[model samples]
Target: MKIEKRWIISFLIISAAAIAGLFWPEAVETPEILSQFGKTEDIVPADVAWLLTASCLVLLMTPGLSFFYGGMVGKKNVISTMLQSFICLGVVTLLWVIVGFSLAFGDPIGFHIDGRFYSVVGNPFSFAFMDHVGVLPHLKMASTIPFMLFALFQMKFAIITPAIITGSFAERVRFISYLFFICLFTLLIYAPLCHSVWHPNGILGTYFGVKDFAGGTVVHMSAGFAALAGVLVLGKRKNSSHIPTNIPFVLLGTGMLWFGWFGFNAGSALAANGTAAMAFATTTTASAAAMLTWIFFERLNGRKVSALGACVGAVVGLVAITPAAGYVTVPQSIFFGFITAIVSNLVLNAKAMKKIDDTLDVFACHGVGGIMGMILTAIFAQGENASLLHGGWNVFAHHMMALLLVSAFTFFGSIILFRITNAIIPLRVSEASEQLGLDISQHDESLDPNRHVPMTILDLAK
Candidate 1:
C-alpha cells in the first residue's frame, strides 16, 4: 500500500521540526529567550514536572472523546464521528501555536470606559508565532513551568471545546463546513472567552471579579451553549435513529476521559501543592457521586440503569465540579456532582419530551451541568472572602452576571458563526449523502464490508 501524500508530507514536516528543535534550538528561539531572562524569578522543579505531566494528560482527552462519540453513532457514521474529534488535535494545535494562544493570554488591547477596564481580548501580536513564549516562566500565569507549556496545556482545552460541540450535529454536518466552523469558533468564541475569564486583565475577572477555576465558564458553558445554537441552526438529523453501535467503545472512552480529567482539573492549579491535591480529590469524588446519582435517577424514572447513563452522569459530574475543583471541599464537590447529574438527567428527559433533536444531549449534559456548577461554585467557594456562604452575596452576584454574559455571548455568537460557515459551504450533506452514511458518502470508508448503501432517504421513507 502506498502512503497518502498528506501523510508523507505531515511526517516530513514533523521530522524536520523535531530535528531542528533538537539541534539548532534557536530555530524556535527557545534557548536565546531563556538566556535573556537568565536568573529570572523562582521556578520550582515539582511544579514544572507536574505541569508537564498534566499537559500530556489533557492532550489525551480528544481521542478519548472520539471513542465516546463514535460508539454512540451508527456504524456507518462511526468513523466520521470519531474523526470529527480526532481532527481537532491537528487543526486547533496549529491554530493555537500561530495565533490562538496569543489571542487568549497576550496583553490586553481594549481602552478604558467610565473608569472601568473593559478588555475585549488579548493582543495577538504579544505572543504571535510563539515569540516571547519560551522556557522562562510567564510569572503572571504559572510561575514554575515554561510559559510555552502553559500555552500547550491551555491549547488542549481549546481543542476539546469545539470537539464537544460536534456532538450536537454529528452525522448531519458537512465535514468541510464543520472544519471551518471550529476554526472560527476557536478564535471568535473560545479565545475571547478564555481571555475574559482567565486573563489577569480580563473584563470578567478584573472588573466583575468572577472566579472560574478551570473553564466551567469558558470551556463547558461556552461549548454547551454553542451546541444549543448548533442544533438549532443545523435542525435535526434526517432519518434519525439514535442507537449505540458499540457499548464497549463508550466504556473505554469514558475510562480515558476520567483518567485524563485529573490533569484537567488538578493541573489548573499550576502547582503541586495543597490546591492541586484538593482539586484531584474533588474531581474524583464528584465524578463518583454523579455516576451513582444518575443511575438512581434512571431507576426512579422506571428505566434500567445502564453503562451509557453512568458514563454520561460521570461526565456531567466532571463538568460541574470543574469550576469548583480548586475552590470547594470534597463534600461540596459531592453536592455539586449530585445536583448537576440530577438536573442534567431531568433536562435530557425534558428535551426528549419536547422533541428537540440535540443529538447526544450536549446541551442537557454540558450546558445545564456547567451552569449549575458555576452557581454552586459561587455558593460553596472556600476562601473567607471568596464565597457567598462565607462572605456575602456579592460573589454569588458576580457569578450570576458572568453566567448570563457567557451564555448570551456563546449562543448568539455561535449562531452568527453557523450562518457564516453555512454560507461558505452548505452546512448539511445532501439527502442522498445522509442516507449513504458519512463513512461512505464523505470519506469513502466503512466498517462493515457487506452493508449496502441506500440510494436516498426518499427511498427509505417509501
Candidate 2:
C-alpha cells in the first residue's frame, strides 16, 4: 500500500475508535442533563453568590503572594514586594475591564478596522487591554453574573500573574520597570494567551479540546515561567547568607492564600452545587497532604519542618491539584499532593546546580506543581474517555505533551518579553534603591503602617 494510503487508514481507524468511545454507553453513569436551550437559571443567584465569593477568595491570593514574596526578600525590599501585588490588583482591574477582557474574549476582528492593525491579535497597544464585549455568565456553566463579572474574576488572574514576576526580581528590580512590565505583560502577553486558552473559538478549545479546570496551566505555570524569565534577565539578589527576610510575614501571607484557595478551586465550578462541594473538599485535602509531605521530608534531614516549609508545601499541593480538582477522585487528590510537594522540594533544592536565580522559587512551587497536577489529572480523571486510572494510558501521552508545550511557550514568550523590557529600560535598580527598600523608593509607603491606616476598598482590593 502507498504511504499516503497507510497514513489515511491509520487516521480513519483512530477516528473510528474515538467515535466508538464517544458513543459507548457507560457501565455506571449518572443521568445526563443535556440541554439545548441552555437554561438561563443555570446562572442562579446562589451560584452567583458562590462565584462572587470565589472571586473574592481568588483576589485574596494576590496579597497572599505578596506576603509570600515579601518575606523571601530582604527587609529593605519587603514593602516593595508587597506593593507589586497591590498595584497589579488595582491596575489590572482597570485594564481588564477596559481592554484586557475585549482582547482576551472579544470577537475576532474583521481586519477592516484601521487595516487589520486594530485586530492584530488584540490591538497591539502595549498598555491597552484586549477588546471586551461584556460580562457573560452562562447558565449551563452555572455562572450567576453577567459575562462581565466572569471577565472581572479572570482579570484578577491577569493581575496576579505579573505580580508573580516581581518575586523573581525582588530586592533588586526597579519599581518603574516593574510597573512598565505589568502593563506590557498583561496587555501583550496575558490577554492573547488567555484568549487562546479560554475563548471557545481559540485554537486550544476549538481544535485540541484542552481542559484546564482551574489555571494549572494558565495561571500557575504561566506566572512561574514568567518569573523564570525575569530572573534570567535580572540576576540574583546581592547578599548570600540570609534566605528569608521575615518568616512571620511569610506565614501571614500563607494563611491568607490558604483561605483563598477555596474560591480559586470551588469557584471554577461556577455554581453552588455538588461540584463546588467536591472542589472545596479536594482543595483542603490536597493542601494538607502536601503540607504533611513537606514536613515529613524536612524531618528526614534531621531538621524540624519550619513554618516556611509548611507554607511552601501547602502551596505546592494547592497548585498540583488545581487542574485536577473538579474531575478526579479524592484519592487522586491526596496522591497528587504528596507527589507535588516532594518533587517541588527536590527542584527547589537543586537550584545551586544552575546559574538561573528564580528569587522566589516560582518555578519550583507553581511551575512544577502545575506539571504534576496535569500529569496526575490524566491518571485520576473519570468520565468519558478519561485517561487511565481514569482514562488510562491512551490519554496520558497527549496530556503530558500539552504540559510541556504550555511550559515551553510560556518560558519562551516570557524570555522574549523580559529581554525586550530589559533592553529598553533597566530591569534592576541601583545599589542605593536596593539598600533603601522599594516601599520608600517605589511607592513612598510602608507596610509598617498597614494596619494603622483605615482600610479602604483599595486596601482589601488586593
Candidate 3:
C-alpha cells in the first residue's frame, strides 16, 4: 500500500496548521472585558437562539446537496459524488477557521478608484485563526447576536458554495485535485465576491448599494459560473450519458433543501423579527410556484412531468428568490419563481447547453436562476431600497453593473484556479479510472461488493 506523495504533503500542511492554531492565543484573554466586541447587553437571546438553529439548518444543506447530486450520477459514481459534497464540510470549515472567514469578513483592504476607496477584499489577518471573534455583538454586522455565531452561520454558506460546483465535473474529477481547486476557489473567488457584496465596506455593498438579501450572487451565481468553468476545463466525461442511480434520494434531498432554506433566507435577517417572518413566507411561496410551474411548463413542451424536473424547478426558485427574499413582497416572490423556472428550464433544454457536458446542469439551474433573481431584485425591490419599478434608477443601474462584474470574476477566476490546480495535481482522472468508475478507481471502495478493484495508477503504468 504505497501512499501517494500528494497525500503526504497534504497531511503535513494540514497538521502544521492545526498545531499552529493550538498555540494561538484566545481572542479575548479575560471574560470580564468582553466589551471590546460591543455592549454585552445588546446581545438578544432570541436572535442568538434563532441564529444557532439557522446555522445547523444551513449546515444540513451540504449533505442534502450530496444526495441531490449523488442520485443523478451513475451507480458506480454515487459514493464518490456524494463524498465530494460531504468533504467540503470538513475541508472548508478548517480553511474558514484558518483564514477564509478573515478574508471574507475582515477589515477592508482596498485602494482609491475615482476618489472613492473601494474595498475589494477583506484583510486576511483581521480574523486569522478566529482572532477577535468572540461572543459579544459586532456593532454593525449583527448587533443582536454574538460575533462568533454570525461567523459560524456564514461558514455554512461558505461550505455549500464550493460543494455546488462539484456537480459540474462530477464522476470524473480526481478527488485530491478537487480538494486543491476548492481551496483556491474559496480564497480567490468566493472570498472576494463575498466581501464585495456582503461586507459593510465592500464596493458592491456600500458603493453600488447592491442588495443580495441572502446569497443569489455570492453562493448560487458563483457556484454556477465556477461549475461552467469546470466543465470547460475538465471536458466531458468519457461516457457522459447515464440513468440516475436513485430518484428516491433526489426526492429526499429536495425535501431537506426546501426545509432548510427557511433558515437560509430568514436567517439572513440576522434576527428573529418581522423581516425574518416575511423572508420565510417568500421563500416558501417562491419554491411552491417554481415547482408547479416546472411540471406544467414541461407538459406544455409535450414532455412528461417528472419528479426530477419538479425538484430542479423548486431549487431554482429557491436560488432566484434568495436575493429578494427580504426585499420583495410575497406576491412578487411568486413572479420570481415563475419567471426564473421558465428561464432556467429553457436554458436547460437549449441545444448549446446540451453540447457542454455539465454532468448535472448546475449552470442552467443555479447560475441562470441567480442572474434572474439579481435582475428581478433590481426591478422589484421596494421601500427605502426602491428598484426600477419604484423609480430608483440608480440602484437598478448599479445592480446591472454588479451582475456583470460578478459573472466575469467568478467564471474567469475559477478557470484560472482550475488551471493552477491541474498544474499542481491533474484535475481529471485517467481514462482507465473513469472506465473503472471513481468509486473503485479513486477510493478503492464500491457500493457493489462483487465489483473488482483495478490496479493502482502506478501499477497500471508498469
Best by lDDT: 3
Report residue 291 deviation for candidate 2 (angstroms): 0.7
* Candidate 1 lDDT, 1-462, residue by residue in tens: 555464566568667755654564233455644443433456788988998898888888889999999999887799999999999998898778777998998778776968867786989866766778777787678667778778888999999999999888888898878988998999999999999888888998777778888889899999999999999998887766767899889989999899999999999999999999999999999999999999999999999999999999999999999998999998889999998999999999984624758878899988998899899988888877687898858878888988898999999999999999998778888877787788888776789877665546423421
lDDT of 2 by residue, 1-462 (tens): 224353466467557655754665443312331221133554467867777888988899998988887887776567778887778887777667556776776554423433322232434332133222234354332246665457667766787788776766677787656766777788777777676567655554333445677878778888888888788778766653456879998899888888988888888887688988888888889999999999999899677879989989998999998887898778778988998999998898894624576767788898888888877777777787676665456567667766677778888888888777777667777655555555655555665665332334223221
Sequence-dependent TM-score of model 2? 0.80
Give the TM-scores of the predictions, in the order they appear: 0.90, 0.80, 0.97
Instruction: Name the lDDT value of residue 456 in candidate 3.
Output: 57
User: Regarding TM-score, does 1 or 2 come out ahead?
Assistant: 1
CA lDDT of each candidate?
Answer: 0.86, 0.72, 0.92
What's model 2's overall lDDT? 0.72
* Model 1 misplaced stretches (Cα beyond 4 Å): 1-41, 113-116, 351-354, 449-462
Task: Pick the winner on TM-score between candidates 2 and 3.
Answer: 3
So what's the TM-score on candidate 3?
Answer: 0.97
Residue 252 in model 1: lDDT = 91
Model 1 TM-score relative to the real fold: 0.90
- Candidate 1: RMSD to truth: 4.7
